[model samples]
Target: MCEANAYLIEGDDKNLIMEAVDTIEPDGDNLLICNIFGEQKVVKASIHSLSLVDHKIYLKG
Candidate 1:
């Protein structure tokens, strides 16, 4: 329940990147995201904002 959904922010749009992300780690210029299902992804984006109350993680690419 503590896991958050990840989104990518570009201009005035938001794109859902991952659902139920368990972790977000900084690796050079990329953001590594891992989900509850053990799926993982590395994106070239930085954290833009977090909406913990809504269980969301926003990133800027």
Candidate 2:
């Protein structure tokens, strides 16, 4: 329930990358995201901002 949805931010657009992301781990120059359903994704991006109230995690690539 504390998990947050992940987004990739580009200029004025925000793209949803993953939902219900349970964990985010650093992988060299990339990030490893794991969802509640066991789905995983590796993205070459950096953390931009976090909206705890909205349960959102934004990243910049």
- Per-residue C-alpha lDDT of model 2 across residues 1-61, encoded as one tens digit per residue: 8999999998999999999999898899999999999999999998889997899999998
Candidate 1, 30: how far from true, in Å? 0.4
Q: Residue by residue across 1-61, what tens digits does model 1's lDDT show?
A: 8999999998898999999999999999998999999999999999989998899999998
Candidate lDDT values, in order: 0.94, 0.94
Segments in model 1 whose C-alpha atoms lie over 4 Å from true places: none
TM-score of each: 0.94, 0.93
RMSD to truth, every model? 0.7, 0.7
> Which regions of candidate 2 fall more than 4 Å away from where they truly are?
none
TM-score of model 2 vs. true structure: 0.93
What is candidate 1's local distance difference test score? Answer: 0.94
